[model samples]
Target: NSHRVTYIHNLFQNGAATIAGVSEMFKERKRRGEIPADEEITFIMVTGDGGADIGMGPIVGTANRNDNVILLEYDNEGYMNTGNQLSYATPLGHATSTSHVGPAQVGKQFQHKDTIQIMAGTHIPYLFTGTESQPQDLIKKAAKAQWYAKNYGTVYGKILAACPLNWKNETRDGRNVVDAAVNCNFFPLYEIEQGITTLTYDPEAKGKKVELEDWLKMMGKTKHLLKPENKEIVEAARKEVERRFKRLKAMSEHPDL
Candidate 1:
């Protein structure tokens, strides 16, 4: 389908409000015949990691209202655009400017926020997570997101993007880093449509599963978590990842979920 797409860039915290306003305007225009009835203009709000953190309130409001818009969050784990400060998305024990590692404290203290589950709680029309390392998976999710936004109500999506600078990793290793994250179940590929969950890619089933510590070892920020002193923290994060993936797997198996 040949549809018009309108992209708006704004503060992550304001993305939801912007989309809501623009979507309403377009709907009114179409209703008044100002815009051709046959023409489709999809509204997309592009947000960053901060969106899932500071912008979460508006996002929940938009989702609850079932606004006709697509919210795309490029989550690099921390507030990469703002000097790599720790955001709620940053995993436990991951070093950022705000979350320092020393004898006093070791990286982030608490577990990271699970934005996917948060969005799923709103029961939006569609929600999914994708990463650039898996191009096909990302593309398919994008297409599905567009379709849901057009036919249903709100669609929320997250892409586990790489911030080489913040991650303290070489730019050339971006794909490998994200790939490791997927194989380690830190970022599983999945989609939830109309409250029905589906696992798009299963690393365990494909014999591609790797230990969570292996993924952590690939980046400097999280390497401390692998230390014996910080073993408890890394183990906690690993358990959380496995728990989430297992829950998703169970959901995918049950149709009434």
Candidate 2:
């Protein structure tokens, strides 16, 4: 029935509704013997961070990750496709359509949701973060996810995406932005296997890590942080980046934890 696949399209109004609809459709097919009783269905949940924010909290607590399911998150740090509006994934002190920085407010006051940590807390069989900047690394992680889901159990992969348009950057500059993010400690490359955490990419070979300012200036979205009056916001962003890096390093050192 590959040629006759059904389609369902909506504004993603409600994640719970989608869950129910998919389950019902699967059941109907099974009841009609379309799928053998012994066979299992592989459910892949591909969602932007927006949909995740709406239903993540409850689903993480309720869903069984140790099954034939994979959650692939294409994280661009905001609702990029939706006119640069702010989403739960938007970083702190960054300007978004919903969280415009001006005299009235200081951009998004809160940092990006630490969904990576939250997923790790689930203690699923596999969890990893991949950046488009590191193509081979991302490919490896994606292959691992597919292998584990088909062989062992479930896996979650959060892949960082770049939005040149939303970020007000040249198309070719997008890769450089991602590179700066990693070098500046804004987005770390790592994976958690079994109960152990490991760092996949490190920029320490260059002696000092790239400055956060370099990353901010790479995209227009974060250019506000470079203003003289916005120095404090820049400092705040640094503090957060350092804090998260420290936590991740600690986790890597203490894998059992």
Candidate 3:
């Protein structure tokens, strides 16, 4: 049988209530014989800064309840649609409208939030990271996300997108910028299935891994981090990437994670 899909956009904070209400309404209609019981419907919500920032609490609650929904996050590292203000997803030492770099402030002072890992804590049935740089991998993960959301429970997926305007990179270089991120293991390709972590692509294994600086140097927002005075922040950012990848490696080896 084929499943019917319904797409909707809501404010990030309202996503959980909207999905819970809509999905239950569909099911209730089926129960009343208004729709066939076997007829399936999947609800998908697309959000950016809305979900990762102010809307996070409700998102987490929905995941905790195992709501039947697919939440896809388009992470451009800032609130791109709203003037490129810094969001929780923005990386440390990255300059945004709010996280300005000057003699007083050196970009954002804190690290970016690991929203994917945070969602994993909700014990959702499926969650993965994807980007346009790896279309095939993204497509596969998306299909899997839909399947899990339809037959199992909630699914979350993150796409590390590029904002050429905000990042101050050439529009034509957007794809390559994202590719560099994946290559440097700054944004690794991976998925967590029912708490079992798996690395979809390993840059180091494929000899494609580049230093964190390689990726940082590609974006204007982060180029300042390369300055001698900003070396400490750059090092911290590098260490954070290594720590996360190492933990992910350990988890992939130990299925109990």
* Best-performing candidate as measured by lDDT: 1
Per-model clash counts, in order, read 0, 0, 0
lDDT by residue (tens digit), candidate 2, 172-228: 888888889989988898888876888887777556489999999989888888889
Which candidate, 2 or 3, would have the higher lDDT against the true structure? 3
lDDT of 1 by residue, 131-197 (tens): 9999998898889899999999999998998898989888999999999999999898999989999
Candidate 3 lDDT by residue in tens digits, 33-114: 9998888766877788545687787788789888898987889988887788999888888999999999999999898888
TM accuracy, model 3: 0.94
At residue 9, candidate 3 shows an lDDT of 61
TM-score winner:
1
**Residue ranges of candidate 3 with Cα displaced over 4 Å:** 1-7
lDDT of each: 0.89, 0.77, 0.87
lDDT of 1 at 103: 92
* Residue 196, candidate 2: C-alpha displacement in angstroms: 1.2
